[model samples]
Target: MPTASVKLAVIIVSYCNVDDVDRCLKSLGRSDWDHFEVFICENGGEAAYGKLLTALVGADRTLQRASDGASALDRPHKRLASVTKCRFQNSAIVVRLGLATENLGYGGGVNAWLEPLLGVLGWDSVLVLNPDTEVERRSLSELIAKSAEGFGMVGGSLVFDSAPDKIINYGLHWSRTTGRVIAIGRNAPVGSAPSSDDLARIDAISGACVLATRSFVEDVGLMAEDYFLYMEDLDWGRRRGKYRIGFASKALIRHVGGTTIGSAVAPEKRSHLSIYLSARNSILFARRFAGWRWICHFGVGLLFAARYVLKGSLSAGRIALAGLLDGAKGKTGRPDVAPRPH
Candidate 1:
């Protein structure tokens, strides 16, 4: 197939963040990339589907609702969602929406949204994007080109939207010993390219923007859902069989990250969901791949939890500690905790 003729499925999973989704669609207004389809899931299940539908199709114009196929999206939950089809604002970008019956965490939501079409022949590459980010005009095109170079998976250059010229990270470094992740190019100036040393250390790409070819998914399977929210990208990276990871430095992306699960940008205001998941998944991930070093991994994880207590974030501290304990006991799925004010 001509690389340009390859169909791309752009997947965005949202959690009732209608405004964020709206802004994301608006960013694509200037994009000239055609032959792509945008698939969305309102995992929030608060009728954000209706709002997103209005946002994409516009109130003045109505488009036919394409049967979303979420009713058949398989999981134990067997979630059924209302799906819609529309054209994005001022662009040829096509969109499909899924109103989830329940709140599936980030990883699960992606599976729920894209599961129905995973085997369909319409697309050869899939770009999983977070709704809280805006793609630069050439980002997708750049990502597509990089995939054509034979990388099964590719990640775009992500920058903090708050400071557009500062790098968030080119990719991520997940430590097996500590079971923690550090961004490879974090806080560096945006224009500088990642050095060979930096690229060598990147074990995983940020889930904020990922492009995977059909073969990669068929080989590795859908992204792991065991962690639910955090650490899934690293988990996926660890499972990639023989495929190489690629970076599209010119595919600049602006990310306002951690929008769902109330993961705030400020560490002090960390949400219970964020703290618990991050702390717990560190243990889960380590157990799967860290071998006998899992003990040291948990120790480092506890120290991380201690920082929250030292900083006087009592709720977050408690949540993190509980998460560490739960993860050690082989607990999975959502934690049994109430939402704390972040």
Candidate 2:
């Protein structure tokens, strides 16, 4: 298919953050690119939030609130009319909303939309975006242009939404020996760009904003749902062989990091859900990909748990240990933990 004719499908999976989603949609409305579609997978939020999303898009469609035990994939597709009908943009920019009966987590929510999007809608490329991100007007265009150059997967440069000049992550660097994944260019000024060599070959891209071709998805498969929240991107990147992963410096996105999980700076304020998932998924990912190196990670995890305990954050340490044990047993999905005060 011609690059110009190829349609890009932007898929965003959201939970309860209606305001963030609204901002994302507004930013998309200002895009200079014309041929694209937006899919919002509402993964179990309040009925009021769903209504708010409908109002923001100004698209008329019957909204259905999912009940208990209803799977996200089982929810019917709700097609909304194009809010903007200009000749250039026309109905070419369409927004579709899908309701998940309950929270499917990040990977599952994306998978719920990916099947119909690529299978039924027949879009050429798909961009998996976080609900807490806002893309620059030229961001989609830059990503599309880079993908056309034979890169199967491309990531946009992500900067903090609060401090637009600072970089959150360009991509990631995975260390096999340590069984650790580090975000490249994190907390650095955006002006300090990585060398062209580093940008040309990235270990993995942030799931916050990534574009993947249909062929790439078919070959590598969708995000592993086993990980409800963290490290699923690293798991996806491990499959990279013939397909190249790249970072597009021109494409920019602003991210409000940890909106769902709570702020990273305040460990005391962070959610038990975030802490447990990170701990569990890291070990699980290491065991799956790093083999014997998982032992190294386990040791490192112990030190972390010990520190939390020494610092008097007993709950944090306990949660970490619980995650480690569960991961060792190959258990997955949301843990049954009580909600702690932020």
Candidate 3:
């Protein structure tokens, strides 16, 4: 059911990078495509920057404020009593300028806005771009064309910030041996073309620069919200047997990768949530999709964890272990502040 009028809804979820969001919108304004609407999902910021973003992008830009809102999860209201008792009384001093609600990781933030973009706005395709990214003029056109080939998901070439020709990630690849996923073309001396065949058929693509058709959304469905920050892309990519996922190599964007978490955030801490989710969700994903293959996958994860600890990223190992514990406890939400970056 292809529509004659294809409207793309581009969503950028903003946490702390107001400058990055401003640059992203400027890049989007230079896009060659015409039929699109952009929205910013704001989770934990003052309304001032959000208002400034809306002014730059357009007055029609939708801003979904997560602050000052009730928990999306249903815990007993009494449980929040303690968190509120201390913070609520003093909240009047800074609540309006600070985060009103809890942080919804990448999946939750994007889904919050995208669900409405699809259900209410009747958009035919949805594009999820990171705030820290700036797009090339040709990127949008290339993504739309690749997506038209019946793939439920599509990703573009991502370069490091401002190094347009230098590739950051051409796409993502999964390692069976380590149960690890690596960004292809990571810091690879810039401007080498990726495999055309690989681009045409992929296991998964990064959510960083991806587009999904309406049917893709209705069928494969929105990103799994349980993953607060990471692995949703892998989870989405694992669904490829039931859906199509491809790469638009011609499309290009730049990422200031690891903005929220520092490069030194320790592999264990940096990847704690990732390790836990990769472990638990890999099992969950395999149970639903991969079958016996996950046993082998868990073995690979152990080896990978060992490699991280051996490399002196004990924090990452700690985080990964914590993630596993949380997953085992069936926890679903963002971890607090990530140990303040050492």
Best model per TM-score: 1
> lDDT of each structure?
0.77, 0.74, 0.61
Best by lDDT: 1
Which is better, 2 or 3, measured by TM-score?
Answer: 2
Model 2 Cα lDDT, one tens digit per residue, 1-342: 235688888888877777777788778878877688777777655574446555554334222222232323234643211112111123445566666656778888888778655555447788999989999998888888888889888887799888998888878877777766788888877646667776654677889998998889889998898889988787777786678876677788999878866645566446787777877888899889888888888778777777778877888888888887788788888678654543
Error of 2 at 24 (Å): 0.4
Q: Which is superior by TM-score, 1 or 3?
A: 1
Error of 2 at 121 (Å): 5.6
Q: How do the residues 33-126 of candidate 3 rate in per-residue lDDT, one tens digit apiece?
A: 7567665555654554445444433234322222343432211121111111101121121111122244667787777665544546446788
Task: Please identify model 3 stretches exceeding 4 Å from their true place.
Answer: 1-4, 45-101, 185-193, 263-296, 307-313, 328-330, 336-339
What TM-scores do the predictions have? 0.91, 0.86, 0.73
* TM-score-superior candidate, 1 or 2: 1
Task: Give per-residue lDDT, candidate 3, residue 303.
Answer: 66
lDDT of 1 at 100: 72
Report the lDDT tens digits of candidate 1 across residue range 1-342. 236688888878887788788777666555556778877778776557667666556545333334334423222234545656666544455677777777677778788756666746668888888988899898888888889999988997799988999989888888876777989988988777678888778887889999999888888988887787888888887888798889888888899987766775577687788888888888888888888787898899778878887988877888888888888877877566655555
**C-alpha lDDT of residue 204 in model 3:** 74
